[model samples]
Target: MYNLKFLLLAIFLYSSCKANISITSIDSLISVTDDQLYENNVDYITQNAEKILKFSELNNYEKGKLYGNFFLGVTARMHGDNENMVRYTFAAEKLAKEYDDKYVLAFIFLQKATIYKEAGLYNSALNFINQGLTVSNSIQQYEKRNCAKGKLLVYKAICMSYLNPEWKQILRINLEAMKLLEKAGKPFGYDYNYLNVASTYETLGELDKAEFFYRKSLKVSTGNLKGMGYCNLAHLAFLHGRFEDATNYANTSLDYQENNSNKRYRDIAEIYQLLTKIYTETGNTAAAKKSEKLFEYYHNKENYTNELFKKKLLIQLLAKAELNQKDFEMEVSKKSRNLLVFSVISMVLIICLGMIYMKQVKSNRKTIEKNNEQLSELSQQINNSFSEVLELAKSDDPAFIPRFKEVYPVFYQNLLSRYPDLTIAQIRFCCLLRLNFSTKEVAHYHRLTIKGVQTRKTRLRKQLNIPSDADLNLWMMNLG
Candidate 1:
């Protein structure tokens, strides 16, 4: 009985551990699929993604569900299943947003942009590309953010080519995309970049540059991309009227397409069309007729696929439009909230500035008032000193000259410095005149007649180089 109990406990523990391991393995599978999404293995992705979705549902794993749906959407796109692609991607987008997974959200935006581009909705595609870039800004992983942004820019350039085929602008955008991808690491979609730039150079009639890029594209291409490169080269040869080279390139493209499991119908159709023209130009009516028939078949098939895709896309667009309306309303609410916050901040800033200004003004007023008080006190002191000096002079005290020199040192020094030859009597006469004393007052103070005072003034004027018309009393006061 003890052994049986231990065995039961061990079985229970093993089962629980196995279940946890299974869930962990699902997550691991999803992670691996995420990295391999950009590769050419659609079947592997679809198979693993389906398994992930099934087990994720059983285990209630959020991240597993998100990636499973996303990877499946990507595989649907590869297989040209427009309806399932939109459905799975939208489902994944909802989950991504719910979890606040910015990296996956950005990639979803990129996927949507590619969908729109494939549907011939260039403006919509560009809008999604912009949204992808906006979301990519918030991704914490440096390499992931750069890779996401680079892929978006690549699609943006492609959309621009369709909307406005300005070759130089397209070239610049493609080059920028290349730089960003290179910074991210061994760029995932470098073949597409080379292919786009090659087409642009070809359009611009830069044959040498176009050929260089075309070869570069071919060098990196695999599967459908290899066929695409050959088809493009065929078109380039056809454009230059090289019938034999065009025929060879077109045949090579057809051979690759036939062997490629993930065949691009449009590229194949384009190759057939090119072959039709090449055979016609070379005077092979039989081959031309066969090529023309094949071109019609493939071209019609491509058109039928596009029509079906557009119809499904239209339905999804309508649903998306309704969702977009809700999003628009939410955006408007967000903007209004932001605007309110900004207004509050601005008001606070203005109030702060006003307070600072008022404080500064009050400080300046106090400074000015203090300065005025100091000036008034100095003026009063000067007036008291002058009254004492005047009283000394009126009393004819012997100390009057020395007192005057102390009270008006600048005046005494300037007078002596300019005319050092003045005698004591002459200096005393000049001092009374400096005090604004009249000629009679000077005569009374000095006990001299008015003529003697006038005679001294005339001599003093000559000695000091005073103008004759200038008043002597005023000149003596103004000397200092």
Candidate 2:
């Protein structure tokens, strides 16, 4: 009960006063690679991109322009805007040339090779990777050179798996890259390479070797890399009609992928394609279409993706609107509660002021009921002391005294603390009388007289805030 009250107090305290992020109109169709992912964290991509664009506009190499445009290109690729990817890359390359930085050229060429690789142009990808490698070698950047070689080998392996697509050739090149990367002690980027090789071997109908290297790849990779490696292994299992195993592995991959950035779009697209194939084989056209559409949605180039993104943006807008409506309702409810609380507080204050005015009038004048109430309280207290002294009636007792200053004080005093105007005391005192105190008894107990108590009681009744004599005691108690 205490916890619940605290929670309610917290909600009331926070309420509608909290700073709200009024979602501005999102032009999602035009806002490609738009909102910063994980808004609470530093929007590193956006910060750097702005720096780059600012520098480029002024024809300067300010800040991290090289990395900024590279990332922009990568994001454009995810949104399937191949034209934007190329454009961004071209801008970055121009900046790189301006600096005469081989590292920048190597990086840009690597990025371009990745673009070509995604488009299924093996030779084009190799040409770009080779250019990157040449630059890496000239700079004597062994780690980066190894990275370039690893990337080139992976591209060749992928092209081999798809084009002419000799599984043996794919396996051989990937294996060679694996050994080289390991020897160079630069295995970070090439973690997925071995898994792709194993998958290729599986396509060549070598399940034993496929299983072998898949496990090997998994041993070296963890987190999303491991998730993807398992996903590929699952694909092989799906090809072998192991649906249960496939689903299990795919689910693990998704679990990891969901928490991480969606950086592996092409790989995930392939995974979905495999799932689509499985669904098609099982005669599940709806499921197959969903997977196929998802694959095309992520894998295809600019124009088609832009059309799809427009449709998706409409759906997202509807969803965001629904969420905003719910947020508004929560806000409204919070405001209503604040109003109710303030309303109660205002009413209490008004009644208290009325009681205080009556007390003043009693000092200056007198009333018949004022005389009568003290007599009543006196009689009641005498009876109570004789009947039995309640523990609460003792002056030194915790319940008898005002807990604040540890002293005996008026019933009206406690009421004034809460209402500051003896707001409900007029009616609430009647309930006090029902605790078996007469007007005189109440006065003697609280240290007042028959006339004084009666005067106060009469004033209390007059000051009762509620209209129509609706038993203000009931109303106040109900607030608890």
Candidate 3:
């Protein structure tokens, strides 16, 4: 069901919120099988979530609603839908904070840390994981606290592994996690810990140790973890120069992965890369090329770009939140006399600025109108010049480049100064891009396909080191 209230709540929470919550739906979510959670049965999860939310609302069970949002967030995460995952996670955070349940808070915090870690904000991820650890320490249940602590240690190690490639340190942390898991007698869901330790040893150039743990993980794990174990063994086999064994292990990994809905992209990428190397070493150029293409395809298909953007924005928000709290504390520390004096001074400045602004606005308005008239004429002349050059380009006239330079000397000079070796075709594309032409318009103007224009823009962006999210046209305009 389409839920207007839930949608609105999600929006409001993203903006910011507070609410107490119940955990009824959390139990239901926990009881669900991994297959059911990961299968492409979107309608099943959506309907289940809606029912849980509706029941919670009707019964005034805030905990259930909170858990429903968290469940939805996890489901969205599985689907690689970061936007909805963020929304649902934010909603859950609000309720968890309001409820003041240490266990729930710890769990929610761990989920957020994982989300941020996946998004590539290692610093922000580590901060939240520490918060989870602190809260988990306060939990009354020994097994629950131990399990949460263990998971958090693994999460922290994962983030650190990214920030620094010191495999031994990461392995030490994972070992601690493993100890906690063993102490809790709940090591069933944590085969990834072993895989991580093995991968770290592989990174540290300890193939025998890596193989030992990989086999251990395989013995203890099933599904995606088992698939990942096979993937690692394949990579290890290739490293050991056993091409046939590598091929066998890689195929086994793919078979398991193909049968399961849960994804492990790194494992898939590694498998393809290993296969490519194997084929190359075994003198199968055709198979090697195919595997190399597959490797690139999987690597590019990983949702790293958007996730990194989200993480960057989220870290900024977290910094702003901390700054706000510091400002509040400073405000609370101020004396009444200082506050009164500051307020009076601010009011006086505002009134003075208001009168000055009124006179300046009147003067600037007439100046702006005159400037607008001149700008319109200049813009028309520039457009006409561009059109002439474009027509010349269509005819393959050698004079087109010089004529374009004569018309837009500043822009051309700026581009030339920055990129002296830019091709004539690249220069033409830049002119269109600077004029803020859409992809379709640029394609039509150049008599090329849309994909060709897009490819040009992509290549140019990389050449210029422009960020994916940046406005290329605005950036080009500013260059001049």
Top-TM-score candidate index = 1
Rank list by lDDT:
1, 3, 2
Positional deviation of residue 143's Cα in model 2 after best superposition, in angstroms: 1.7
Question: What count of clashes does model 3 give?
Answer: 5
- lDDT per residue (tens digit) for residues 385-411 in model 2: 323224354232432322211211233
Determine the C-alpha RMSD for candidate 1 after optimal superposition of all C-alphas: 38.3
Q: In terms of lDDT, which candidate is strongest?
A: 1
Q: lDDT per residue, candidate 3, 1-480, as tens digits?
A: 469889988988865433223243344554462235433345577667766767777767876777677667767766766667777877878888887767667867877787667645577679899999999999898977787788889888888888856777888998899888778776464677788888888888999999998998898788777989998998888888888899999999988876777565666777888888899899999999998998887776554434333433343334434454455445544533454455567886766655555565565557556445434443544455567666765565666666656556679899989899899788877876776778888777568899988898899989989999998899888887
Q: Tell me the deviation in Å of residue 329 in model 3.
A: 11
Question: What are the TM-scores, per candidate, against the unseen true structure?
Answer: 0.63, 0.43, 0.59
Which window of ten consecutive residues has the lowest lDDT sum in model 3?
Answer: 17-26
- Candidate 3: segments with Cα more than 4 A from true spot: 1-49, 262-266, 303-480
lDDT of each: 0.80, 0.58, 0.73
